[model samples]
Target: MVKTGISYSSLGSPDGTLPAPQEVARHAEQSGLDSLWASDHLATGAPFLESTVALAAAAGSTTRLEVGFGVLQLALRRLSWAAKQIGSLHALAPGRLHLGVGLGGVPADEWQAAGVPVAERARRTDAALRALPSLLTGRTTELPDLPGASVTLAPAVPVPPVWIGGGSPAALRRAATLGDGWLPAAITPEGVAEGLATLAELSGAAGRPVPRVTVTVFAALDGHLGGLSQDALVDVLHGQFGFPRELADAVAVSGPPELIAERIAAYAAAGAEHVVVCPIGGAWELQIELLGKARGLIA
Candidate 1:
């Protein structure tokens, strides 16, 4: 079965009045959702919370619901610092944290503020991904640039499953080589099939097992579309994320509950092992309830 999760951050709630993370986590667990995800953003014009803090709040409040960073910008922070944060969270909720790492685009100012050269994001991210497991598991690991320095984490916890997120070929290759899962947002079923094929070829060539696949989608249940038409939703998405209309429409799942369920089923058929539904409007609690119903419809 394709597992389903929901985004816990502010992406879908433009009004900025999202419920407390603890409340959201409790609700998700009670609703029987498989996971809860939060995004990492250094700076943004929109209302947002720090991803790690948000996940920690969620994990601390719930027992069964898996908590994840939808895609933490690993390249922006020092690997040691990132590893420590992840390890701490795992200690708080062992066996229930999923780390999704990626090189995020947009808000170029964030990269500049973080002191991460935009041009070297891939390299920095690759190094972080390669070293995180060792650091989190209490095994000594050396920094790539600081060759003589070695460090190990204390009170080590099981390394969380790391999912790589991005749509570029380099991102796919990185996922095939270093990630336990591949996570990409705003992709169509056909796109997923194509990407999975590429991932399979790359993983086979590298003699690694194929990584699990997950996709994040923007969606709204029929009555909860926030009075926006399909075209209006596309426009809003383009303004917020700069996605082209066609691309936005391709990835936007909306309409009746059954229709939403059908769209997710299509993605599962295309080989997605999990789908993270990001509600695209207010009434988030209602959206979560609706999403749970949709998940029941997926085979």
Candidate 2:
């Protein structure tokens, strides 16, 4: 059976109130979800918690539920500091951390504020991934672009599974070469099937086993429960999140629990090993309960 998870990002109430992270974490764990994910953003012109701190709160609160980054922008922080934060989290949570790395493009101002040129994100992300494992495990890893310079971090923990996040071809290449898993958001089942095939080919050429697949889908269970409309969800994806209209329509799973379960099954049939549902509407806790029901029907 494909594992199921939810993004704690949705815990921000429709009334603009954000729930306590530990409360959200405990609710998810009690809901029997497989994992809990948090979104990373330095600035998106909205209230947001720092991703690492959010995940730490989640991990500290739940015993069984895995905690992860849906996608973290590594280019915005110094690589060593990033490694240290991840290592520290792993020491606290042990085997429950899933690190999702990506090149963040939206809100270019955040990158500029971080002193990272927008164009350098991809290169910086790739370099970070290459050296991250060694750094996390306490090995002396050579710093990228610094000839003969290396750093060894103390009190190291095992490197968490790194999931490369993006729907683009370059992301697929990064997953094939440097990641333990692939995480793509707002993509359809057909897209998942096609991307998996491409990943197979790319990993084959790279002489590495194919990375595991995880799909983060935007959903709203409003048909029966009554909350956000499907059209509104699509608008959020297209207008707010920058997905193409057609792709957003094809990927956003809305309506009743049965309908949502069917979509999860489609992704499973397309070879996704995991699905992380991001509820776009409804009461956060109620929506999570509904997603747990959908997951139960996914076999």
Candidate 3:
């Protein structure tokens, strides 16, 4: 059955201490969330963190509950290398990995620093997506020069579900044509409805199944999860994302319980197959409880 889940970017809440990734993973799984998703931001963690490693730990922590990269920038990584890494994870996690991809269009200086070119990112990403399933499935593909320099991936484990992310027209088309699902973030009711129409056309053109739709939405419930107020939550939204306060507030989702429920229903009505709520200001457990209750779905 379709399910509800949360996508946590890190182990800890904004304020203080956190359990190890494994512990957090167990708690989330035990809470009844069907899956766990981690953002693939290498630098976002203040101390030391990497997405895949934490997810590996999460995998070790639980026996069930699907785990995914909330988003990993395929555009920046080498296709062959990424295939090997993700393929190994798939072997370990078995049927639980969801490969979420995005361009992110990160700053050039950053990409250059990492030995990748910003201009070539999109093209490379497209190539990677096409090549990943093939390479990961144990067939050797040529990787330029150095003839016979083929690398077979770890194993042909359960094929990781690929979900594309981003909001551009091209991204929507990519999701419908090449992805198992679409993973969009910070989207609105109107935006989702419009995008789904595009997806339908793209799916028909590509002769693929009607693509599934998942979302990474910014959400907050009544009262303080940690110590931040609803208004403070709005500020965090605007500050972190550089979104305008007015528009951010429009999507912040606060106040009356009835409104929150209606908004969630509106999201489902707008074509979301699975919506991953991101509680902006709250204790992790509290966020889990409030959102799960509000959405009438278990964690």
Candidate 4:
């Protein structure tokens, strides 16, 4: 069965205000949502919270709902610092934390702010992924190509399952080799099927088990999409993610509960093990409640 999750940030909300993380967490757990997610952004000129801090808040507030970084920009931070933050958050939620890492492509200013060379993000991200598991597990590990000093985290925590996010070939290959799952955003069911096929071939060549698959989509409940026209809804998605108008319209889910449920079922049939839904333009809580109802119709 496919699991259903919700993104906790205000990234896709029509309004800039986001609910308190604690409230969102409690509500999600009570509503039976499987997981809650937040994204990482540095200097995006948007009203976004720091991903790790936000996730920790959510994890601390809910005992059963899994809290995750929808896609944390791991390449932008020093590995040691990133590992420490993740380890600390894991300590709060234990087996309930999911670390979804990605190569963030946005607001060039963010890369500059982090002092990470924009061109080297892929290499840097690969290096971090190679070493993160051991570091988070509190094992002594050598830092790659930096000045000497093997390190180990104090108060060891279990390594959270890492889901790699991106749609590029390199990203898919990395997911096959290094991730516990692949979480791609704004992709169609056909795209997902194709990507998973690539992942399977890559995993086979590497002698690694096939990774789990998850897809993230923007959706809104209600028959009329929170009073926005279909054109306006597409515009919001384009403005936020710069997706082509046609692609944005094609990938976003909107309409009555039955239609939304059918869309999710399509993704499940295409082999997505989890579908993370980001409510686009509506009362966030109401949308979540409706989304849960839609999820129930899938199986």
Q: Report the lDDT tens digits of candidate 1 across residue range 142-178.
A: 9763577889888788878889999999889999999
Q: Which digits, one per residue and each the tens of the lDDT, describe model 2 over residues 1-299?
A: 99889998866865677888898889888988899998888987777899999999989998999999988889889898889989988888889999999986658779878988888888989888988988988999898846678899988788888999998999999999999889998788999999999999999999999988999998986656667677777888888788888888888967888999899889999999889998886687898888888877776
TM-score of 1: 0.94
Clashes of each: 0, 0, 2, 0
lDDT value for candidate 3?
0.72
Maximum-TM-score candidate: 2
Q: Which candidate is the best by lDDT?
A: 2
**Model 4's TM-score against the true structure:** 0.94
Model 3 poorest 10 in a row by lDDT? 41-50
**Better structure of 3 and 4 per TM-score:** 4
Where does candidate 2 clash, by residue pair? none
lDDT score, residue 128, model 4? 89
Candidate 4 whole-model C-alpha lDDT, 0 to 1? 0.84
lDDT of 4 at 218: 82
lDDT of each: 0.85, 0.87, 0.72, 0.84
